[model samples]
Target: MASHRKPRGRSAGIRTTPAVGITTAALTSVALLSQSAQAAPAAPTAPSAPVEPSLDEVKKKVDDLYHQAGVATQRYNSAKEKTEKQRKKVDRLLDGVARRADKLNEARQELGSFAAAQYRTGAASETATMMLANDPQGYFDQNHLADRLTSRQKKAVDEYQAEQASATKQRTKAAKSLKTLSESRDDLRTSKRTVQRKLGEARALLSELTAEEKARLAAIERKKEREAKRKAEELAREQAAEAERKRKAEEAAQKEREKEREKERGGGQGSSGPDTGSGPGPGAEPGSGATKAAKVIGFAEAQIGKPYVWGATGPDSYDCSGLTQDAWKAAGISLPRTTWDQVKVGTTVKTADAAPGDLVFFYDDISHVGIYIGDGKMIHAPKPGANVRVESIYYMPIHSVVRPA
Candidate 1:
C-alpha cells in the first residue's frame, strides 16, 4: 500500500520538479509586470475646448464694472468733502481749546497767588482767634477778615477748576474728531483705489480679446448707439407732434373765445395776439433763461473731445458731474461739486419737461450727471477712456432731471 499510494500528502502534488517551479515563478513575475504596465494610467490627454463669452456678455460685464466704479467715485468724492469739513472743524476746535487752555492757566495762576497771599498772612483758626481776642470788637474784626479771605480764595479755586475741566473736555472732543477725520480720509483713498483697480481690470479684459472679438464688440456698441439714437429721435418727434397739436388746439380755443367777445361788443376786428412760441424767439434778451441755456450748451459742446477723468473739474478734462457743474458755471450758474449735492440745488422737473442746460442725473445713486442739449440729446463725460460727447439721454437709467438755472 505504501508503494502504490499516489505519494502521500505534500509529495502527492509536488513535482520534485525544479525546472517547472522556476518556469512558473518566472512567468508569474512577467505577467505581473505586464499587468502593472497596462494598469498604470495613461498620460493626460489634451485639454477640453474653452468656453468663450459672447460679445454682448462681455460688454455688459464691462459696463456693470464701470457703473460700480462710477458709484465708488462718487463715494470717494463725498468722503473727501466730509473729510475736509471735519478737518476745518477740528482745527477750529483745537484753536478754541488753545484759547481755553490759556484762560485755564491764567485762572490757575490767580488761584496760586491767592493761596500764597493766604499763607503769607499769619492767619489762625477762627475759633482759636475768637477765644484769644480780649475784646468783642477784635473778635468780630478777626471773624470778618477770615470770612472775606476764605470767600475770595474759594471763588478763585472754583473758577480755575471749572476752566481746567472745560479745557480738558474740549481737548478730548477735538482728539475724537481728528481720529474720525483720519478714518474718513482713509476711506476716501480706499474708494479711489478701488475705482482705479476696477477700471484697470475692465481695460485689461477689453485688451485680452482677439482682434476679431474686438471688432465684434465695437460693432455691437455701434449698433446699440444707433438704436438708442433712433429711439431718442422717435421720442423727440412724438413730443414735437404733441406740442404742435396742443398749440393748434389752444389757438383755436382762443379764436372761439375772441369771437364770443366780439359778438358781445357788436363785432370788431381783433388784433393778432402775441406769437405762441414755446420759448423766447431769436430776439430773446441776452440774460434770459434761453440765452443762458444756450451758453451752457455751447460750453458743453466745446468740451466734446475732452478726456473723462474721475474727480476732475477742469478745462481740459472732467467727470460726469464735473462737466455738468462746470458747464453750468460757465453759464453764470453755480452748481454743487457732486451730483448728489447738485441735484438738490435746482428745481426738479420731469424728463419730458427738461430743457437745454437742465441737469440730468442717472443711476439709483445719482452718481452720473449730464447736461441736456435739447432734441433728446445730452453732453456727458461717459466714463474712463471715453471722451465727453453728445449721446442720447436714454443711454443710462434716468434718476431725475433738474433745472440748474
Candidate 2:
C-alpha cells in the first residue's frame, strides 16, 4: 500500500466561488467530505414545511461557514507546503535507495563470481565452498585455513553483507519518507474538501433564499460597511491626534537643541553644526521600508478585482496570505505563506498606527489577514465568493495589527 493510514473528513456555509466547485467536492475528493451544520437541502419544501431561517440568521450562518472555509484554506496552504517539501525529500531518498540497490546488485554479482571461480577449480559443492568462507568451522575450521576462505572469498562475503545492510537501511528510510509524503498529500486533500463542503453549504443556503430576502441581505451588508466606515473615521481621528502630539514633542525637543547650540555659540555668528554619525543615515532604513511598502501597496492595488481563490498566490487570484506574500515579494521582502506565520514576522502595532502596507489580521484565532491600505481600510481577498478588493477593516472582528516589511 502507498499508505497504511486512511483519510479523514470536513464542514460548510458558502459556495458562490467557482474555486470551490460546489458540484465537485461533495464526494469523490473525500468520501468523508463532511456536510456542514446541515445536509444539503433536498427539493424545495412544500408550503407546510417548517419555516426557513430568517435572512439575518442565514447571513450569519453563511458568514460562519465562510470563516470555517477560510481557516481550512490556511490549513490547505500549510499542508501544501508540507507536501511539496516532503515530495522533494522523498525523491531524494528514492534516488539514494536506488543507488544502494545498484551497489547491492554489484556486490551479489561479485559474490557469484567468487563462487564460479571456486567451481572452476572443480570444487565439490559451490554452496558449501561459499559457506566455508562464511562459516569457517562448518567446512574445516582454522586448521585447514588454506582450504577455508581465500582472502578474495572473505572480501566478497564482507562486501555483499555490507551492501545488503546499506540497501536495507536505505529502503527503510525511503519507505518512511514515502509514508510522510502520502500523509501530507492526504492532509492537503482533506483541507481542500473541507473548504469545498463549507462553500457548498453556503451556496445551498443562498440558493434557498427568496429574492426579497437576498435584497435584504444586501442591505444588511451595506449597513455593516457604513458602520465600518464610521469606525475607520474614528480611528483616523485618533491617529491624527497622536501625530499632532508627536509633532509637538519634536518641536519642543528642537527648541531645546537650538537653545543649547546658542549657549555654545556665546555671543557671535552662530551656525547649525552637522550632527555627525556613523553608518547609513537614520532615515536610510525607514526610507527603504517606505519604498518597499509602496511597492507592496502598488502590487496589491494591481490585484484588485481578481477572484478570491482559497490557496492561490498569483497575478490572477489569491487567498489572503497569498496576496500579502506575493505583494511583499514584489517589494523584495519575503513573508511567510500563512497568516499565522505572517503575523509573527513583522512588528505588531496598533490599528491607529497602521500605515499602508501593514498586515491587518482579523478574528482572535488570527485566521484572516489583509494589507492595511491606511484610512482604517485594507485590501484583502475577503471570502470565497468575493474578489480581491478594498474593504473596511471593521467588517470583521479586529485581532491585532502587524507591520510586515
Candidate 3:
C-alpha cells in the first residue's frame, strides 16, 4: 500500500511542475529585465547652467585700475622731468668744459709759434725761419721765455683736457640715466594699457555664467555698496558735527576777543599797556611762530575758489602738492615740486606740535601734501572725482610735517 501511494504522489507532482517552473522562470526574467531598465541612469539630457561674472564687479575693477594707472603715469612724468632737467645741466657742463679745452689748445698753438720763431732766429740761415721770428731781439734772447711759455701752454692744455674728459664721462652717464627714465615712462604707459585690457576682458567674462551665479555676485556687490554708503554717510555726519563744533568754538572766542577789546578801550589811554606778546592768531595755535601764522593766513586767503586737479602742481588749477607749494611761496619759502620731497624738507612734528604753515603730508610715501589749517584739519585736493576741500586729518593716513624753504 505504501509503494502505490508514493508512485501516485510522484506522478501528480511531475504532471504540474514543468508548466509552473516555466511560468515562474519567465516571470522572474521579466522582473529582472524591468529592474535593469529602471536602475540604469540615463545620460543627462540637459547641461548644468553656465557660470557668469558680475558686470558691476568688472566695472569696479576697471575704474580702480584706471585710477591707479593714471596716478602711476603722473609719478612717472614727474620723475622723467627731473631726469631730463639733470641731463640738460650735465650737457651744459660738458659744453663749458669743451670750450675750456679749446682755449688751452689755442694757447699752446701760440706758444709753439713763439718757440719756432726763436729756433729760426738762432739758425740764422733760413729766410722763412727769420720771418717767423717775432722778437725784436731776433728771437734768440727771448728763447727762454718762449720755452717757458710753451711749457705753461702745454700744461694748461693738459689740465683742460682732463677736465673735458671728466665732463664727457659725466655727460655719458647722464645720457644713460635719461634713457633709463624714458624707458621707464614707456613701460608705465604700456602697463597702463595692459591693465585696461585686463579690466575689459573681465567685463567680457561677465556674459559666460548662468543667472544664479550672476545673482549671487549681485547680492555680494549690493551688500558691499550698502556698507560703503553707510560708512560714507557716517563720515559725513562726523565731519558735519566737527564743523559745527568748530564754528561754535570760533563764535565764542570771537565774543571773548570783542569783550577784551571793549574793556581795553574803556580803560582809557595807555591803560592796556604795551602789547607784550602776540596771542594765537585766528586759525593758529599758540607757541607757534609769527612766520608760521603768516603762512597759514596766506594759504587761507588763497583758498577762495580754486579748481582741483588730480596730480597737477600748477599756477591755476592745483592739486594737493601744488597748493602747498604756492602757499609757501607766498610766505617767502620755496618748496620742492613733489609731495614726497616737500614732506621730507620740513621738521617732523606731531599733530599736537603741528604749527600753522607746517606742511601736512598724507597717504603712504608722502604722496599728498596740504597746509595744516589748525584744529587737526587740512585743506587739500583729495582724489579723482573730488574737489579741493577742508577735511579732518583723521580721514587720511598722515605721513609727517614739512618745513618750508
Candidate 4:
C-alpha cells in the first residue's frame, strides 16, 4: 500500500514519525544509500557526463527505491502467505481425491465380481463377463442385466457410479486449487524479484558515490535521526501538557461531584462512593489491554538487534510487518501477514491515544508498520541492511494507529 512519501509537513494537531525505509541509511553497515548507509565521496566527474545526479538527488533516488522495495516486500509476504494456505488446501484435496479413487476402484472390483457370478450362472452371453470385465460396463448394460440384478448388485452399481462422480468432482477441485497455488507461487516470485530489483538499483546508485559522499549521506541520515528525536521530544512535551489538562479537568469534576454528594447527604462527612473513572486505580495498567501490550512490546524489544529481512517472520530477522505480526502472535494474536491487512485488524486510534502494542502504520500507502512502545516512539525493523530498532513514531509520516490487541 505504500507509495512515494511526499515532502514532510510541519507539526500539526497530531503527528507520527518517519517510516523505517525513509532514513534507513543512517545505521546500516557501510550505510551506502545508492541505498542504506554512507561511504565516502565520489571522484571528480568529466565535463561530458553531466547526467550524473548530485548527492542529494542520489540520496532521494536511493531512498525512493528502498521504499518501493519495502512495498514489494509486503506483496511478497502476501503472496507467500497465500501460497502456503493454498498448498495446504491442495494437499487436503489431493488426499481426499486419492482416498476416493481407492474407493471407486474397490466398487468397480465388486461390480465386476457380481458380473462374473452372473456369467457363471448362464445369465449373460458375453465372454467378457466371464472374467473380470476390463470394459465390462458396456457389456453388462447392453445385455439388460438390471432386471436380473439383485438389490445388493444394484447397490454396488449405484455406489460405483456415485464414487466415480464424487472422485471426478474432487479431482476438478484439486486441480483448480493446484492451479491457484501455482499462480500464487508465481506472484510470490514476481514480488521477490521486484524487491531485489529496487534494492539493486538503490545500491547501484550508492556505488557511484565516493567514500566522502557516502559519509556525507550518512551524516545527513544522522541528522535525520536527530531531527526525529527532536520531533519526538516535542510531541512528548505536548502530550504531557495535554495529559496535565485532562488531569485537572478530571480533578475539578470529581470535586464538583463530591460537593453535590455532600449536599445530598446533608453535609455529613463520609465516603461518597469509590471513584469510577477519574483515573487509573493503584497498580492499574496504563490502559485497558496494557498487559497484552507489554507482552507484545517485550517480544519486540528482545529482537531489537536482529537484522531486517524482507518477508521474514522469525527468531532471527524480520520485516516491519513480520516483526509486528510476530510480536502480536507472541501475545496470542494471529495477525494477517501484510501491513495492509495488519492495519485493518485492530481498532483505529488517534496518534496521541496510541498505547504500547498498538500498530503504527506509515505513509499514505500503509506500507510500513511498527509496534508502538509509547513515549512517542515505536520499535520497528528498518530497511535492508539495518537492524530492528526503536525510533520516533514520527520517524515517518504516520498513516494511522491501530490497537491490534
Model with the higher TM-score, candidate 2 or 3? 2
Once superposed on the true structure, which residue ranges of model 2 sit more than 4 Å away at CA?
1-49, 123-159, 268-287
TM-score of each: 0.73, 0.77, 0.51, 0.80
Q: Write the per-residue lDDT of candidate 2 for residues 139-182, one digit (tens) a residue.
A: 43434533566787667667767777788898999899999999
Global Cα lDDT for candidate 1 = 0.83
Clashes of each: 0, 6, 6, 28
In the range 1-405, model 4's lDDT, one tens digit per residue, is: 977888556763224445444456455634444453344667788678457778888888998998999999999999999999999999999999999999999987887787677678876634335234554456557766666677897688778878988999999999999999999999999999999999999888888899999899999898888988898888788778888998899889988887777777777557656344555664356544776788899999999999999989998999999999899888788999999999899799998877789999999999999998877899999899899999998878899999976
C-alpha-based local distance difference test score of model 2: 0.83
lDDT of 3 at 105: 66
Which window of 10 residues has the lowest lDDT sum in candidate 2? 7-16
Report the C-alpha lDDT of model 1 over 83-185, residue by residue, as the tens digit: 8899999999999999999999887677566655555776443433433356523564655744555676556645765787789899999999999999999
Q: What is the clash count of model 1?
A: 0
Error of 2 at 85 (Å): 1.6
Candidates 1 and 3, the one with greater lDDT: 1
**lDDT (0 to 1) per candidate:** 0.83, 0.83, 0.61, 0.85
Candidate 3 lDDT over 1-405, as tens digits, reads 456553456778887999899999999999999998889777868877887535666546644554454445346435655666766766776676677666656654654565566577784323233224554234434443334445654464355445545556766766776676677657656654654564455555555656886787778756765664555456556656777898899878877776686687885455555343367664456434556557655675566356765445666667667677777776666777676567667578665556556777765656666676665666776654356676666555567766553
Clashes of 3: 6
Instruction: Report lDDT (Cα) of residue 69, candidate 4.
Output: 98
